[model samples]
Target: MTRTARPRHYLMCRPTHFEVSYAINPWMDPSKPVDTDLAVAQWERLHALYGELGHRVDLIDPLPGLPDMVYAANGATVVDGKVLGARFRNAERAAEGPAYLDWFRDQGFTTRDPEHVNEGEGDLLLTAGHVLAGRGFRSVTAGHAEAQEFFGRPVVGLELVDPRFYHLDTALSVLDADRDEIMYYPAAFSPGSRAVLARLFPDALLVDEADAEVFGLNAVSDGLHVILPEAATGLAARLRERGFQPIGMDLSELLKGGGSVKCCTLEIRAAA
Candidate 1:
């Protein structure tokens, strides 16, 4: 009999104000909103979908000032049975860690906190042999070493150059398990990071900045399922042709904060 692994559960935050950051290039049209009511409806729809897909979904009250909190993946990490709520490097997002801790405690989760001031979850990437922690952007190299010591797993440090792709999820994601194939954006990864990635998965698919911008090279979930934006239709079609189920959503509001599907959804627990 084939064994089916249990699906991971997560918490998703709703956006309080759907406005884009003016300093960032991609701006959501402030003049026209599809419908504030529809936005609420879509959030509920996603909530329902995750539940239907056999995932435990927790809904958190939206924080007014932190609009990007909906991308929960950036704020937390899960290893084994423990959930680590990250301490965001951005002052605006630091509040999210305590909120996550409270949420997890209420849900009966045993959680861990980063040892240092730097604890953004997006910096940590789970690989077969070890976890690759991006040193630049929101998470620090010290935090990576701490994670290694705590988990007893090797940790590789990486430096991120672009602020837009501040987190590793913005430019890279693990796909196949056995082969360890990764989909990564070339520009966002450092030379050392690339070298480590190549050694782990020699045939890793290198995606471009444009594709990553459109969320085309983010995460591939459950081997066959992928969570990406509607903008990646071509990539979606290719994935479908390869017998993969591509789930697309219109994350227009998330673009304001430079995050997407992978950013907002934190998988707290997954079976090995």
Candidate 2:
């Protein structure tokens, strides 16, 4: 089957305040130097790339103290215009939850404040058949029930075992939601979750440890085009072999905070 590109609407936050002042994840280190200007420059290129690809990009104002707010994908999960807001597990990012939800509410989207802790799109990913919810790290399993009820879609709970791939978005990328196609790292998930994924997507693209380390699975796709980190050369080739145009980007600066293409870009799947 031939791949096709569809223009998508995205929500992004400029890396104006991007930094890794604290270590919440293994990738982050307080002692490591972060060049704020470089992060913003790289992020600007990403924002421009979306426009060049004919995708609409809308930006959320970055809050001064919220450095991680640049990873807007962690803000909220929007499906069919209904918004399920985030509730961060760590206090470092706790305020980000409400800030992102307020943006959705301000935009006139239907909003629901979550009952349990789930890091928005970080733990919840939408596929054609179901919503893949992540657990065992950042988001709680109970939050899966909340997402299932709100989206009116079957929520398949997957357990993340790796600290580096703490969030679901870090370990998996839904390549084509219409086809329920995905690309993921098997090791980041538990054995049962791996089995679940295999059963659900037998033809899904699997990534190696090298690609997973560079946050290759952290990607954004528009059916035909898969935008991922440039470092994942192997994954890019695999995406091409599977009939998708892979656009490689250098988001190495953002990697210090454990985010990449998908983390910085939040898909706004509005109701048709």
Q: State candidate 2's TM-score.
A: 0.99
Q: Which candidate's TM-score is highest?
A: 2
Write candidate 2's Cα lDDT for 67-139 as tens digits.
9999999999999989999999999999999999999999999999999999989999998889999998899
Off by more than 4 A, model 2: none
Residue-pair clashes per candidate:
2, 0
What are the lDDT scores of the predictions, listed in order?
0.66, 0.94
TM-scores for every candidate against the unseen true structure: 0.83, 0.99
Q: List the residue pairs that clash in candidate 1.
A: 71-264, 72-264
- Candidate 1 matches the true fold with a TM-score of 0.83
- Model 1, 1-272: lDDT tens digits are 12133466676777655444433223344444344354555556666666766778667777776656676776677777566668876676678788777777777766777767445456777766667677676788777877777667788777777666777777777665434556777678778777877787677666766667787765536565676777877767766665667788776555545666766677665433
Pairs in clash, predicted candidate 2: none
